[model samples]
Target: MCGADRLVKVAFSGLAPLVIEDVVVEGDLIRVRARTPEVAAACPTCGNVSSRVHGFGLRTVADLPVDERRVVVVVRVRRLVCPTRGCRQTFREQVPDVLERYQRRTGRLARVVGSVVRELAGRPGVRVLSALTICLSFNTALRCLLRLPLPPLVVPRVLGVDDFALRRRHRYATVLIDAMTRRRVDVIPSRSADAVEAWLRAHAGVEVVCRDGSGAYAEAVRRALPGAVQVADRWHIWHNLAKAAGKDVAAHSACWAKHGPPLNDGPLARTTRERWHQVHRLLDQGVGLLECARRLNLGLNTVKRYARVAEPERLVRAPKYRPTLVDPYRDHLRRRRAENPATPIPHLFEEIKTLGYSGSFNLLARYITQGRVEADRLAISPRAVARLLLTKPETLTDTQRTRFDELSTACPEMIDLTNMIRGFADLLHPRPENADRLTEWITSAREADLPHLHAFTRGLDFDRAAITAALTLPHHNGGTEGVNTKTKRIMRQMHGRAGFPLLRHRILLD
Candidate 1:
């Protein structure tokens, strides 16, 4: 070693280097007592080198252990004076063991601390660097990462780009996820064309851009990387289709809701239904039914065809009118109900029939029974309601129609208790002006710029008049919403700590 350098090495080594240094060990660590003066050099800017040192600072810096023990050497550092005229240059000089100009810790020690910061702790390497006696913010930690000598980014074959808004609806960022690897490649600040373009240009070999339908991305890809094939993603297509269908169904919900009763099930009901409708047509046509029925080839025996059957009682049976029963059980039912407030229906049926009531046991009981019973608590068979649902107006006589209207009014709350939200959707469609609050409704839809959603909307936007014809239609986003909900649940299970790596993989892969 050179004379000056050798003296310095020996001073720091306790016995010096290039020769044996007597080493001592401490438990779990080593202590090397070095007395070397800090090295000095000229500031090339000033061309001044001085033996007269500026001032020395002491630090007990960690180093590689002499043997197995950790070696921390207490060292003193120095600065040189610039002797050049017109130069404002007294600067701390660089040294072999120490990092950059005027650094306190050696290069090796700083690196060890930085490594510990990265692997052992998630602390930003630069901020942790302060622990090594250097002061820089966590941003400086980024420099350490950058300093690792990054290789050129290898373009993946297929890249997926999607935007996620982090804070509710306000702040958005782009995630450049890898479709093949199913991992996040990087994140960009915005969905802007420039930002996406910059990313594409930086990674040269990208083959396919898989994206949800978005015009912004399309424009960006065209301008930035024209050669890359852009494939429309599935998620957006389905999402938009669902949205359009939902609106269509919502507006026409009532049409679907009221399909149960067709006004024409049995032959009797069908005839009545057609005749009644024909009567309305006559009224609408400004022609009386007698002439119309002649045109329709109907018999005048039909009550509606008879001009003198004006009073409803002439054509229809009076409701609550009892049958002329030859039933044997009638007298017994009369006795039991008169004596008791509650008579079980089955017992009544049995008692009346055994007494040789001629009318059907069910008919006698149904005719005799009287109470304010909840529809659900009704003792009669449910098949009747199902039958009624399929029944047509023609199957029911004028008397039956009167009875039906009375029963319908008896359960007036059914109309109000029906699916109201569904009703609201219908109201948005073809509902009457008075029934709908059209004055207040803003009919325009607020749509997102997503391409899939846009394409889906195009179908609805095309034939809006047809969709609006009925107030009740059946479109549903239940499945899509359900999928998103399930995704959140999986995320929480993965531990509120999953990175984009896990999230991206789970979604695209699945």
Candidate 2:
């Protein structure tokens, strides 16, 4: 045999039982003409061996690409007759390894398609396969992906579970991961307690469950695994604390507003203080929040916000000024104006133009008319003060530290809130002593006049066991949270067009 023929045989080795006759390239297509070797074939229906040839037939199938060209294999096979009594059926010879029954592509080629579709899933998979000289439609690629099986389920000793949004507020799903290995186990379609309970009941070997402080999840775990130790995620606990602290800061806006920079006396600030007084007057007269909003021509939420502050001074804030060409030349304008209070507008514009001011005369005239030149320093908002209070003291910059200290010590209530936040933050690190510290912290929080922190303590008391375990145990849902982040990327890549089955499949296999 020629070396070329031997090389062709080796190239088509995946089609083992078929003999290569000729390999020819026509334009961009490579066609291989081959024939199945003569051998006895078993009758599939009757399980009898038959070698008698009944008829000759040709079958064409697509194979892997060769040299960036499409490959088509045409094989000649013989139909054999069954020799068994009363079962003289004519059955075609089969090559199970090279090609599947009734499939038009080689098994090896199908596997390659499955892998590409597994990663990219529909039109993207088709585009990638087409680049490799393999033709496939989007639906065909999705079919290949769906054909792939899921990984086998192995219950982990330490399991972590979390929920992620599918459509945010409308749809959500749950993700389970092995906390020890950080491998994703399953993706449940719904975040309801029944769904989670069903999943936990099926996979029974979990000894410890790490999850966020969702009441539904806690209830499901309690019902599904009565003996399993539940550990609340420390990050979620801190997140809940931060939320309550923000509300507490907002409630005491009157106190922190005094320590912030001087408030603007602009028209907006005047309107704000006027509205606050009007809303409080109506509220003080026994009017409902909605009724006060209707009477004052304001939004209900706006009325509620105004009602939260004790004094109208807290409602006055700094004007949000946009940048202007006159900003850089403010000192020049201010100095020149102060030298001669009666200086004409045109003279100031011309003087600053020589110093590189590129704005119009009307802009400068408007800037002076609006009295922006006399604007005071902007006051800090309650939200910003809340963030400053929650941050660690060592991480603050010099300027930030001064501002934090001033606001934190604005009133007795502010001081108490700051201490409470710091005390709760200290319990996040797991140690045996932290459990007792958490109990004491809750007791102290309830004793304070801070209503927001009182609600926070109530939540901690409701899930005290899980909260205690989280404060004293090392188990956490950090891995599960990371997997949820990855799942979000997958959902974005799929463009929200896929259903739960495809998403579940990718989460398990990818």
Candidate that scores best on lDDT: 2
The local lDDT score (0 to 100) that residue 447 gets in candidate 2 is 79
Worst 10 residues of 2 by lDDT: 370-379
Which residue runs of candidate 2 sit more than 4 Å off their true CA positions?
A: 1-18, 36-57, 77-97, 257-379, 495-498
* Model 2 Cα lDDT, one tens digit per residue, 1-510: 699777776778888778888888999999988888888988888888889999999999999998899999999988999898788579888888664578789989999998988778888888999999999888777767777888888899999999999888899999999998998888888999999999999988999999998888989999999999999999999999889888878766656664333446768878888898898888879999999988878899888778866677655543334567888887677677778878999998899899999999999997776565544323456678889998989999999998888889988888999999998888888999998898789888887867778878989889999999999999999999998888887887673355788888877878
Highest-scoring model, TM-score: 2
Candidate 1 weakest lDDT stretch, 10 residues:
372-381
How big is the positional error of residue 411 in model 2, measured in Å on the Cα after superposition?
Answer: 3.4
Q: What is the lDDT of residue 270 in candidate 1?
A: 50
Cα TM-score per model: 0.34, 0.78
lDDT of 1 by residue, 287-372 (tens): 76677668767775452433322222122211222234623444455567778848787777676567665566556555554331
Name every residue pair that clashes in candidate 2.
none
- With candidate 1 superimposed using the best TM-score fit, by how many Å does residue 420's alpha carbon deviate from the native? 26
| Candidate 1 Cα deviation (angstroms), residue 323 | 47
- Superposed on all Cα atoms, the candidates' RMSDs to the truth, in angstroms, are 20.6, 4.8
Model 1 TM-score relative to the real fold: 0.34
